[model samples]
Target: MHGWRIPASVWKWLILLMAGGLAVLVASELHVGLGARLPDGEGSLRVTLEDQLGARPQGLGTHWLTVAALDPRSPLAAAGVRPGERLRFDRPLDRWRRFAPGERVDVTLDSGRSLRLTALPTPVGLADRTDYIGRTLIVFPALLFTLAIGWHQPAQRAYRSLSMMFLAMSAAFFYSFWFGAADGPSALGKLVQLPLNCLAWYFAADFALHYAAQHTGHLRHWLAHAMRFYRPLALASAAYTAWFALGHEAPWLWVPSTLSIGGGALILFLSLVDGWRSGRGDLRQRYRWLVLGLMCGGVPPLLTMLPWLDWETGLGRITVLAYFGGQFLTYCLLGYAVMRYRVFDFYLAVNRVVVFGVVSLLLLCTFGMLQHWVAHHVSAGHSGFGWQLLSDAAPAVLVFLVFNKLHARVEHAVHAVVFRRWAAREAQLREWLAAIVHIRSSDTLVAGLAAALDRFGDHAGSAVYLRLPDGGFALAASATGRFPPRIGPNDPLAVLLRADLAPTRHQLPQDAGVLALPMCHRAQLHGIVLLGARPNGESWRPDEITLLADTASQAGLGLQALRVDELQQAVGSLHAQVRRRSVELQAAAGRRRFGMDALP
Candidate 1:
């Protein structure tokens, strides 16, 4: 409560400001680092990641790869080079991306002719720039996700912990790739890395604690205990880093780095595992991608950073790529998951993801084939750049023409296979909608309406309220006991429903987790359907809201029609009794005359 604290109202803005500052500093550092590594000599080498990994027609694992690309005028080429030849480097593919200009890289060819390949002392090469861009792309999106999720649910523990985790992770990755210094990792970056990683470690636990359906508490208590241990170490580490930066001989800070990487990663992984074990179906699904991300992103660092294992880069391109690949994929997937959490979950999140992906791939492949055909068959006579452009444009135009229908067909086909289990639930929902039309009884209509909503397993509870003779709506049927018994004519829910006859959102709130939709027919509010909270704590998706609204509309009409039918039957019965009474009276009139006559 003492040192410095921003008010809750402006906390999101504070985070944004911090992000901006960090981005500026990172950009400047990257620019300087890239400039420092600029090639200073005219010498050149044309090796890419694929070239360094080697060109093999067939083999397995590390045995399949490792070859150096040699430009005709380059030193490696001048020495000796041949087709289908292999070579080995001192470092893996990742390290190759960070090679400093004028650095002589030692290699051994398949022919046993060992040589040192002098990396051209020139500007940042295409491969290096590409690597930097790719890693940055991966980090920034995850970072942005943190801001997004936090902004939406600022009070939630998951948002704060998740945001901090990615922030630290992004910073750590920046240090990994850019290193800040041309010669090696910057002293400043190294100085901050320890504490940032430690912070990440603690936040990982914080996320674990809060990611459940219930949060630990509403306040930020993440650093309560961890800060006590982290502070003095941070001060000492800062002093040591400054000392080392001044060219003094200081002991390398392996202790803190090792502890942070190992401790933080383990804590994250174990927490996720614990949650998975404790949670149910959809809740468990939230952890799978995160655990995978951790496994893929965590293992390499543990194996590499720990003093015991002493992991090295000689484990082949595949291993190295997988290491980086894991981080990239993990972050990308999380970014997607966090950003689209509420907007895109129905059936199975993963299934829909696959459906979209497969459809997109099919479209791309077809378009590519069309382009290839046009390039080879239609572009033979094309000479000018404009003509070539026209040839390529033809395929694009054709693809665009067919894109919508083709995408729909492909998407539907993919969904049919991918979402086989969910398909039945969808069919059941449609069947429920259809079944409502024939429901003639008022009691049956409202009961059936509640059951229809209950069929889809999202809401915790559901209720159907029908308009009474006095103009108030009373709960006619409920799948669960959460809803109120009656909504009076002057009740806010009733007032709003009367005004608009539409669905209510969280704005005009009553009880928690309740979404009220009006059942309207001929512009009159016939009934109201209230759906309780989702069990997983997520908002109702668009498709779900659409389904509920459609159900409410049809149910309203059916209820209105049933009421009309009952009124018609009552009137018809009254008419039949009146006619029968009249007939009896006419017969009695003749009998009464006979009785009078008899009495005289």
Candidate 2:
């Protein structure tokens, strides 16, 4: 039923009503039906005595008893009276002789059965009180906690956890009612109890699974399987308990149910404790508190089972009230945990809390004042001007304070965690660009350039191919990879060069990579520099584009200077070799003429 497709908020109210009903039922059975039985005040008392007893005992004094309302056929009925036998009074007291309302009396029956009943002025006691407590504070808060956690998380896990907890609590309350009224440890009792144990088991196990998956050191595959085994085992135990209780001896009926419920509960507690200890940060602290709340919540039910701990006639009612208190505390803690941990980004919780808290307070106050005014004249009742002013102003103030704090916190956290990394990467890029600018030799320059481009495959491979005086292009410098083969007069780059335009960034045709800059020098078009795409396929950012342009300009100047210096050195060396050879040839000719005269 908890799994049915209803709004969580609606389910919350429903659960509250059901829990209250269960508490009331339990109180009625234990206090009025089991412990005391009083005469009906107005309608049935006179007729019931006339029909059942036939003739009343003589000189019998009238006694009054006020009994709480209860189901007719319950364990207490079986304990004191035989099936189908009616209680017979010793004397029939006249209806007008009855005690005043809100009075208690003990009545003696002819069959020696004595009954005591206390008057209920408003049919609202411990059971109703528990119901109100759970509805207003516990169930509603639990729903809020679920919404806070589920708002931005993976839906499946959140849904499972919420359903499990809701159903578990529901089943537990339902079973508590049965345990009080069931006769002779009936088979039906066992069947009813199974659902409760199974729900509780699955809820705890699923919660642990979800929590563990988010943190480090998760259960291994086999261990996870074992953990999952808890659900079915608990369910099976419930089934077995039901089957055995139907036919087995009374003492043995509750064994399986007790084991399953106790075992699952113990394991869940251990898991919560372990998780809280190992976890870190504010999230962990919040979780620890939540776990503590859960553990505390189990105490009331456990106490109810202990005979020594229970008080007299209203023990069942007191036990239920205590349980409701635990539930309230647990739900509040869970909501707090969700908000503190940023489970779904606490913004939504903050907004809802601010809005609802202000609205409800104002509305309730106004309604109370209006109700009094309706009974008496407006002049005799309290003024609602203060209520109206608060309702109008509180929401606005809450919105302003909440949003302002949220914005500041989000900004600080983002700047600290995300943007600082980006800044560091940018600094590294600048250092690389600086190195490229200073390098002189063509080979060294290419290697450095290659290293820099490797950081972003923004340029796969590039080369500085200068247009020579003969109109052919020469490879001046190159990075590691193969150069583009088509580098000639007919190429598109040559056409751009002949047109004599300033340097610009261009993309090649048909995925033909990118060119960051067309090298130019001394007001003349020098050559084309080719670049390729980065691995991530991201376009260069504006700062990166500017850096690329600067690097290209510096490289062009270095290439021009190096080329001119080498050419001048070559010419001077050639002149020296030619002059020395000519002097040698003249000396050889003079020696030959002197040899001819000596021969004559």
Candidate 3:
């Protein structure tokens, strides 16, 4: 992007599209299939997933089911099930996937009692659906963003690595969502998922290492050394996951994952520090955005997934959603990064997504949390129907009322604070535009433009070329440095301005360190604004250039308005002089016709 062009690969795009479609299909099946008649285990059961109760029996491979509500209609209740009681069968629950409809299964209770129960699939509830939706929301953006990067910069090695890393991370989340065990023939892919999880951490760390190593010089040598073992470590971790899947008790599974993530985190932190310390301008800003996104996206999962935290304490299904909320924030940050880095020429798309996506996510997330909190205080079983309905709808109602206002504030914050330089300048330009309308003098217009140009540019020396009556321009106002006193109508600058009103490099003396922005209204060229180079020696970005050109457009319109005002004033003065002369002639003629009056 700095100089060379990266061509998009057609085959890569087709593959990405196919993969995205498959993902959508899989997610839809998982979501819609819930509570539907299971072809194999043709039954239904309602229970919240909770931790194992007491200890597993010596013969009962692992605890299968727990946490049953006292629903008399449930198949489990017919087996005399109680809350917090462990339910298992003659075999593991994973093997019960093939039971026919109405097939009898024997269950062993925690009290050493045997009861016959029918095989049942888990029931889908609102909470379940919410959790499922939230998880989808979490990983969806990663795939989309990965696809975007692949489409935009597939040729870049760093970007390709970045896309792969994001894809792996999303895959890991897909397997880990709901935190359920692989308990069915349908879930046989969980064996592959274990290895995928480990790959996620490895790829994340490796990508971060490479990205930082390339950008920050201090970390290059160590990062290169780490890269030497990158493939080996990744293969080793995958092998360990396979061993774990094969019923081997390998505690070392986490060791490699931890080492990879830890290394990556360390590299990102150091790169951030080094960048802010030594880097300048846009490069430093990019490092800041990337680091911020990592912290925001990665830190919360660590907190939420902590062992000590009692997830059973009213956080049951919501904890999963909490994870979704955090991941979405990370996506927002990534959106900003992609735009800021110019990875794609789609800033407007990303901007709307960042601004509106953050707001909508927060709105829905708040609604979900409020609903969860209200349900905790007023028990659904005990509360009146009206009270229950009111409680359930309150969160939605609240968010609905404030949505417009919230979106406004979020948009304002994005423009005024987060994207200060890029968007805030537009607001300032409007103020300049307001001033330009009332003042009719060309000097005032020139002075206002020069000031605006200097203020928006980084310590810039800005000057405005005043348009003359004979279709020439003269240097009228300079906010900082000098320029050519006068420009001929036949000069190349005038010809370019008249033909097309776009900014071009100023090469008056060759290496003048200036940009020439033409001011035009309608089809008429009015003037030109000269913008100096930044003190940091970095050129203005494309977006910034566009903004300045917009400012020039405003200046041109203002100039046109001033010309119209001057012409009106001149016409009024001519009319007044004509009336006065006509009146004097009429008085002289009357005096001549009256003879005495003429003598007088």
Instruction: Estimate every model's Cα lDDT from 0 to 1.
Output: 0.58, 0.47, 0.60
**What ranking emerges by TM-score with the best candidate at the front?**
3, 1, 2
Candidate 1 accuracy as TM-score: 0.55
Candidate 2 stretches greater than 4 Å from native: 1-137, 143-154, 170-194, 214-229, 238-253, 312-318, 343-347, 350-600
Model 2 residue 335 CA deviation (Å) reads 2.2
Error of 2 at 182 (Å): 15
Which candidate model has the greater TM-score, 2 or 3?
Answer: 3
The order of the candidates by lDDT, greatest first, is 3, 1, 2
Query: Which residue pairs collide, candidate 3?
Result: 591-598
State the lDDT of candidate 1 residue by residue for 1-600, as single tens digits: 011354545657766665555556566655555334322212235553232211221211232134435456666667776545776554422232344556677666778888887766555444444445445444554455445544544555555666666666666545444524333434344444435655666566556555663422322244334544644554455455344334333443445544544555655666677666665434555666567655766665444332344323433333344545676666545534433333212233443553365346446645754665566557655689887887679888988888888888877765565345345766787898788777778898788778767766454678988888889988889885477788787887788888987787644445623577889887888788888776766555455576778878987887888889999999999999999999999999999999999994
| True lDDT of residue 241, candidate 2 | 47
Deviation of model 1 at 237, angstroms: 5.7
In angstroms, give how far residue 179 of model 2 lies from its true place.
17
TM-score per candidate? 0.55, 0.38, 0.58
List model 3 lDDT by residue over 55-95, tens digit each.
Answer: 22221123345654656666767666778777655443333
